[model samples]
Target: MTRSTRGGAPVAPKRVTPRAQWTRGSPGGTAGTPHPTASRRRWRRTVIARRAADHVCETFGADGIQGVCGHPEIEVALAEFARYTGDRKYLEQARLFIERRGHRTLADIEFGRQYFQDETPLRETDVMSGHAVRALYLAAGGVDVAVETGDDELLSALRTQMANTIGRRTYLTGGMGAHHEGESFGLDYELPPDRAYSETCAGVGSVMVNFRLLLATGESRYADAIERTLYNVVAGSPGEEGTSFFYTNTLHQRVPGSTPSPDEQSPRAASSLRAPWFDVSCCPTNVARTFASLGAYVATSSADGLQLHQFVSGEVKAELAAGHVSVAIETRYPDEGTVRVTVAETVADEWELAIRVPGWARSGGLLVVGDSEPETVAPGMARVRRRFAVGDVVELRLDPAPRFTYPDPRVDAVQGSVAVEAGPLVLCVESVDLPDGAGVNELRVDPAVAPRVADGRTVVTGRMARFEPTDWPYDPEAEDVDETAAFEFALTPYHRRANRGPATMRVWMPCA
Candidate 1:
C-alpha cells in the first residue's frame, strides 16, 4: 500500500512535496526548478502526512486509511502531484485507489456497513451520504480521476451526486452535516435548524468540492455554492475580525448558556458564543487557509473570457483565449445588492464576462453594459459579450428585499414556522434585542411587514402574541387562556447573535 521513495522510505511522491513551494511562489511556476527551502519544508510535511497515511493504508488495506472511502484522500494527493508533474505512475496509483473503493471493505466497524460510504461504489452511488466532509473530499478526488482518465461515465456520476448534495442536503448557509451522531448527512429535507451539526470543516470541504465541480463543468452553480458558504458559514466561523472561532454553525439557538472561559471547553456540541480556540481546532486553520486563497474563487478563466463568481471588491486578471483581461470590482455585496465592474486593462478586443445571479435573487437581476440599455437577467448567470475599453463599467443590480422562507413539510421541526432571509443572510431573533422576561421562543413575526436596516443591523419589526401558559398541554375542550397585549420585537442575522453576550436566538418564528 505504501510507495517507496529514495532510500526505500515510504512517502508520498516527491513532486507532491512541492506544494508548499508552489504556495510560496506563484502557482504558475515552471516545472523545471523549484525553490530550495520551501521545497524542503513542504517535503517534511508531506513525509509526516504520508507516513500517517501509509500506516493507515497498511492497517486497513483496501478498506482505506481513515475509512473505506478514505482511499480517495491519498488518491487526491497523488493525482494532484501527477497533474503538476505530469507523472503517469502517480496517476496509476490514484486510479488504483479509485478502483478499490465501494466494496464495503470496512463494513464490520460498529457504526454500520454504510458508515464509511463503502456500501455503494462511486460510479453507482446516486445519493450523497455518510460523513459530509468525507463524501465531499471523495467526490473531489473522483473529479480529478475522471478528468485525468477521460472517464465520461464517472464524470457524469460525480455530477449527479453533486447535484443531489446541493439540491437536497445543503443548508441555507451552504452548511452540510445535519446529524451530530456522526457529523453526517441526513435524509432529504430532514434539515433541522436547532439540531444542526453543520461543522465548519464540512463547510470548507463543500467549497473544495464545488470548486472542482466548477472546473469540470464550467458552470456557475458551483460558484454559487462557494460564494454562499463563504459569506455565511465560513465568514461566521471567525469571530470579531478573526480572533475567535466557531467549530459548528447553527441557524438557531433557542436557549442561552453561560459563556465559557477561554481555557474551558464548550459543553454544547456547537457553541452560541465563539471560543478563542478548541481542543479539536481544524476549523480555525481551515478558515485561515480559505481566506488566504479567496482570490482564486472570485474569478475563473475560459477560452472565451473571464467569469466572476463572487462580488467582493477585488482585482481580477486572467488570460483568456482572446487575450488577457483585468477588471476591478467594487461592491458592498451581501450588505448591499450593487456591483460595479470596471475594466482596468484589456488585451482582448472582444470577449465575454459572466456574472452569477444568485438563486435567491427573487426579483431577478439587472445588468447594464457600458451606456447600453439595462437588461433583466434571470437566475443562474448573466453573460455580457462586448468589445472592452479601459474605464468601461458593467453594473449589476440584485434584489435585496427581505424574504421569509419556509422549510419542506417533511422536516417536522420547523413545519409550522417561517424563517427570514435578506440577501444571503439568514435572520434570527435574539433575546438581547427583545424586552426583559420575553424569550426568543415567545416571539412571532408579522409576514406582511418588510424587514429594514436599523442602526447597521437588519431588523424586522414584528408583533409577538402574548399567551399565558398554565399546563403542559392546553386542553382543546377547556376554555382558551386569556391573551395579553401583543408586543413588538426585532430580528437580526444569525451570525451576529451572541456577539454582545450570551443570548437566546431563534430563526423560525410562529405566524401571528
Candidate 2:
C-alpha cells in the first residue's frame, strides 16, 4: 500500500527511504506546542511533521484512499504530530491507519501476509508476528491511538500481544526477530542464538512500545524490558565513541571473521564486526533518535507525583496539583545498584515520590526515604508519600549478585545451556578470553559453582574437552573423547564483546 506524499508518485511508508523521524527528541504525550523560546529547528518539527501527516491524511485517510501503508511508522508519528500541532485530524488519521491494519488489504509478500501483520485484524490479534520491528511499531502506534481515543478494547488486545511476545518470542538479551531471512520473528521458542538477526532498529522499536506501555499501565515489567534491551542490544550496537555500528546483533558469533574497515559499508545482516556505516543506515539513525530522547524514557511525571524508571543520573521537574517540584537523581546504576534521589525543590503539601526496583532483582532491595528506617522493597514501585522540604533524600539499593540463568525447557535451541547474568547485563565467554587451546564451541561450563564478579569481571568454572578427529564423524558409540582439562575463564558483558578484536562469543554455554 502506498500514499501520495504531499504530491509525488505515491510512496510506501517504510524505513527504506531516509524519512525525517519527527517523533524523535520526545517520547509521547506532548500536548499543544513547544515552549515559546524553543529553537527554530524545534519549532519546525510542528510544521514539517504536521505537513507530512496532513498529506498522509488527505491521501489515504478515511474520506480519501481507503488504503494503508506497508510500513507502520506513519501511524505512530501521526499520533505524535497530533499532539505537537494540537490537531485532532492527525489523531483521527492515526486511528484510521491502526484500525485498517492486519486486514489483508495490502498486497502479500513472499514471506506471507504475516510479514506485515495482515493476517488478522488489529483488535483480534493476540500474538506478535511478522517483521519484528514492524510488529512492534504497529503495537506502539495502536497503544498511542488507544490512549488518545480511549479505546480500552484495543489497548487490552495490545497488552496481551506484548505479554505473549515478551514471554515466548524474545531473546535473553531482550532482542526480537530470530530469522535473518526477513528480519521477522520466528515461531514461539524458535530463537537460535547464532542465527539471530536481532536488528538494532528492532531494539529501538521494542523500547518505543515498552515506554508507552510503561506509562499506560505503570508496570515495572515494561521498565525491566527497557533496561535489558538498552544494556544489551541498543548500547551494544555501536562501537567506541559511535564511530562504527553493528546492523544486526547476534547473540552468538560462531566464527572469528575479519575486522571491519573504518570506511566500508557493511553487509547489513552478517557484519562480523561493527562497520563505519551501511547503505541501510536505519540502525544508526534509530539509535541516535533514542539517545536524543532518552530523558522521556528515563522518567515520567503525573499530577500528584513523579516516577523514575531507568536509574540513569538526571534531574526531573514537574508541575503537580498542589505546586511545582524538582528532583535530582544520582546513581551508578547497573554497575552498583545504589541510587540516591534528592528533592531539590518541593511544595509544602504532601506528595509522592516513586523509584522503580527492576524485576531482575528478585533477591533483596533496600529503600530509605527521609529520616525513616531502612525498609525492604521487592520488584515493583517503591513509593514515599509525605511532606517534603529542600534537600530531602531517598535512597535505593538493589541486589546485583552474579547469577546463573537457564532457559525454558521448551526452547530446544538452548535447552541444556546456562547463561550468566548480573543486574541487567548478560555475560558471555569470548574466544579471546579463554585459556590456551580452549575454543568457545569446544568448552563446557559447570553451573554448580556460582559466578563471581572479581575486578569487574565475571569469572566462571569451565573445562576444555578435545575430541579425536575421524574421517566418519558420526558413530553409533560416541566414546572417542580425549582427556579434558578444567580451568576458569572470565565472562565479559555481551555488549563489550567483539570490541577487543575479532573473536567468537556465545551467550548460552552448554553445561557439563
Candidate 3:
C-alpha cells in the first residue's frame, strides 16, 4: 500500500527481507527492551520507520550513492533513533551522511548547490547559507554527530556559524530567512520586514541547534537564543485559537489579507494572515511537537546544581549530589517581569540555583533572595548558593517597559524606523487600531515621546499624516505632507496580531 505525502508525493512501503538482525546497543533497535509494544504496533508503519534507518545505512554506501537528499532531515532522525534505541551504528550512519555532504554529489538545480547546503562541507561551513530551515537542520544533525563522536572542532565551527547567523541573518522576533524567493537566507543584514520568509520550521530548527549547543557547552547564551525564538516565532505561528496557523511569518503586512479557507492548504504567499490548514502542514505539526516536548528546553542541570532557563509558571524537581531539590515557578512573564520561585522541598544545603536574565533587560535586572532586598544582576545566569528549607521564596524582576528599539544601520529595510518592544515581546501597530481611513504607511511616530503600558496595552504617541497619491512616487517638487490628528494608540504583540480579522500591520514604526 502507498500513502500520499502533503506535497502530493506518493510513498510506497518497502519490504525488507529480514537480512539484518535487529539488535540493541552498538548495532540496532531495542531488542531486549521493547518500547511497551505500542511503538511496535502496525507492522507496515514499523517497517516504514525501520527502513529509514536500515536502508539509508545500507544504500548510501561509498560504491553506490554518495549524495544526500535535498532537504537534510534523515541524518538527525537517525541520530535520534540512536539515542532512543541505544544503537551506535545509527549514529555512525548519521555521521556518514554529514561527512558525505558538500561534495556536490547531487546534481545542481537552478537555485544552486548552496540551496541544499552542498556547496561547503559540514565542518567547513560558517554562517548559515541556502534554505534557512535546511541549513539549520543540517547544522543540528552535524552537532548531534559531533557530540556523540566527541568532535570538538566540528562543534566549534557550528558554534561560529550559529553566532554569525543569529547576529546578521535573524529578525527582531528571532525569525530567520529574509528573501521570499527560495525561502532561503538573505545576505548578512538583509532582513526586510515585508519580505521576511521566517518559516515556523526554521524557528524550530534554530531552537534545535541552539538546544544541542546549550547541552554541549552549558552556556546560557544558547538558552537566551532559544527563549527569544520560542517566544516569538514558534509561539507566533499559531493563531489566538489553536485551529489556525501561519505557513510563513511576515514581519509586516502591507495589505489586509482575507482569512485562508479551512478546507484548502495555502501557498506561502497566501499566508499574510494565519490559515486554518495548509497542504505542506509543516507548521502545525512542528508547533505541536515543539509544544509537546517544550519541557525538555525548560531546565537543564550541571554537575553541582539546577539551572532554570525559561520563565514559565511551573514546578521543577532535580536530583543533585547534595540531594533531591524541588521548586515551584510562578510568573506571568513577557507580560509581567516578576518571577517567583518557591522552594517546595530540599534535602541539602548550598545547592547552586541559577536563573537566566534576558539580554534585553538593558538597564539591568533585580534578584531577590528569600526576603532580602532586590540586588541588581546583569544579563546571563544569576546564581546563588545557600541552605534552603520549605516556605523560602526567590524572586527575579525584569524591566518590562515599552521602549523604542532601533535596528542596525545596515538593515536598509527599516533603517530609519523604530520598533516597540515590551520585555521579550515585540509590539506592533495594527490597522484596526487606527482611525477610519487611516493607513499604517502614513503613520509617523515621535521617538522623543516615551511609550508606556496603560491598561495592559502598550501606548505610543504618534500622528497620522496624509500621503496624496501621485503618478510618480518620487519627485523633486514633493512637499512635506500634513500631520493630521495627534493621538495615542495601543500596540499589539507581534504574535497576537491578525486575530481580529483582515488587517494591515507593521512592527517597525516609521519615525516622524
Candidate 4:
C-alpha cells in the first residue's frame, strides 16, 4: 500500500552510521602500541623540537635583551628546530630578535644588562659575554641570509670584540670568566690559588664559543682548549651518577668548618664533593644541554677530513660530499681508557681521524688496533690517517691510573694536605667511615705512601694519628713524638658523599 508522506510520496526512516570511533583494538587504533612507521616517529620528533624551540623563544623573547641568560639556549633550540623542520622562518625570527640587538661585536652588552633598562653598556667583559657570543655564533650560521643582508659594520665589530675578549679574559689555568659569589668571573688574572671562580657554566660556555670559532676558523687551538675544559673542568662538574652538579670547581680543598657555604668556598686550594643543585640552578641545565648535543661536538669536518676531538661511546653519522660516512666509538672511556672506533660505511677518499689524547695520559699512550704495534699518540694530539673501508676498527687506550694531587702549601685551605684523584673525579673521606667523635679534621695521610682500595673503599692507617691535640702553639717544624695511637679511615669518591647524612667530609687531609 502506497502511503502519502510529507509531500505525496511514501518516505522511510533514514538509518544513521555511527562516527568512526577510535577504540583500543579498532581499525587504525594502533592497539596500545605505537605505529612502527618512520613517518610517525619523525612527526613526533618534529613536534617535540618545535615545542622546545617555541617555548625558549616565547619565554625569553618576551623581554628582549633582558633574556640573555636564556639567549644561548634559545638560539640552540631555534637552530635545532630549523634543522629538523627545514623551515627558514624559525631561523629568520631567531636572527631578527637575538642577533638584531646591536651591531657586530656585542662586547658592549654588559653583565646583568638584561635586567636593566637604561642602555648603560658595560665594558667589563666576562663569561656572560662569552655566552652571548656563543648564542650569536650559533644563529650566525642558520640565518646567513639575514646576516649577509644586515649590517656588515656590526658583524665586523663583533669579530673584533670577541678577539679582544679572547686575548684579555683567559687565565693561566686555561679557565675563563670570574665571579666570587656566583662563581662566575673573577678580576682578570685574579686567578688565586685559594679563590678561583671557575664556574662550570663559564667553562662550558668558553668551550662552546671556542667550538664555534673553530668552525669559523679551521684552527686547532680552539679544539685544544675544548679538550682541556672537557677533561678538567666540565668532566669534574657532573657527579658519579652523572646527575648532581658543582657550580664551582677547584683543584684545592679546605678544612670542613672554615667555609660558609659550599658555593662561596674557594676551589683553588682544595675542593669537596659537588652538590645536587645550586641556588642559581644553571649548571644542571647546562650539563643536560651539553650532553644532549654531545654528538655535534665530537667530530668536526674541514675541507680535508674530520677532526675527532672528544672520545665517548656513541655513533656519529657525517654526511660528506662523497657519501654518508658513519663512525661508531665504543668503550668505557676515562674509566677504562679504551676507545674503539668502527667505520660503518665505506668511503673512497682518505680521511684523517684526529683523536685527542688527554695530557694526563702519558707513558701508556694511545693504542690503535688493526695497525701493527700500539702507536704512541702524543699527549696533546693523535692524527690517524687511513683509507676508510666498511667495518674498519680503530682502537685507542689511554692511561688509567689513580694520581695523587697536592695543592700549593701557600694555599691556606690545604696547607699540608693532598687529594686523591682517579681520572677526573676527586676522592673524599666521609665522616661515616671515621671513628665516632674523631671527625675528618683529625684525619691525616702520608703523602709518601699510597692509599689502596680496602674493604671496597680507599683507606689510610698509620701510627702517631691521635684524636687529641698537642699542647701550646701548633708548630709547623716540631714533629709529634706520640706514636702509639693509630686509626684507619675509609674514603669514597667525592661525588658519592653527602648521600648518606650530613657528616663531615674532606677531599684533602693533612699529610702524615
C-alpha lDDT of all candidate models, in order? 0.72, 0.82, 0.81, 0.53
Clashing pairs in 2: none
Encode model 2's per-residue lDDT on 1-46: one tens digit a residue: 1111012121111111112323323333233345556666866666
lDDT of 1 by residue, 1-512 (tens): 11111112111111101133332222332233334655666555654544554454455444445344442466677677766555455566666667667887664565554556677888998878887777777888888888889898998999899898878888877889888877789988778888888888888888888887787776667877887787778877877755677888877777786665887766436566788767777787888888888877777776656677778898888766677678999999888899999999886467766777787886678888778787887776677767878998988899776678877677777777888888887777888888765677667666676666666766665554555554656566334434345555666766666687788787788765
lDDT of 2: 0.82
Distance from true location, Cα of 220 in model 2, Å: 1.2
What tens digits encode model 3's per-residue C-alpha lDDT throughout 1-512? 11111112211111111122333532443234344444454434545566667777778755557778889998889897777556677788888889989998778888889999999898998899899999999999999999889999999999999999999999999998887777899999999898899999999999999988887876767888998889889998998888988878888888887878888878865677888877688778889999988887877764456778888898887776677787899999978899999989886557766787888888768888877777888877777767777878888999888889999999999987999988888889999999884668779898999999788799998998766667886864455687876799889988888889988899998888
TM-score of 2: 0.91
For candidate 1, the TM-score is: 0.85
Give candidate 4 regions above 4 Å deviation. 1-182, 187-207, 213-280, 369-371, 406-417, 433-438, 450-491, 508-510
Per-residue CA lDDT of model 4 for 1-512, tens digit only, reads 11111112211111111122221222321122223443556555555655655555555454544434334345445554554455544565566444444233233344443311112222222222433333233333322322333544433444454455445444333455444543344333344433555667766776766665555544445555676566656666776666556676543334343322544633431334555445566777877777776666676654434556667787766655566677788977656778888888747887655555665554536556576666666554455566777887777777655667766444454567777766544577766776664556556676666766665566666433543454655764335444446666677665455555456666666777
lDDT of 3 at 382: 79
RMSD from true fold, candidate 4: 17.5
Per-prediction TM-score, please?
A: 0.85, 0.91, 0.91, 0.59
- Backbone clashes in model 1, listed as residue pairs: none
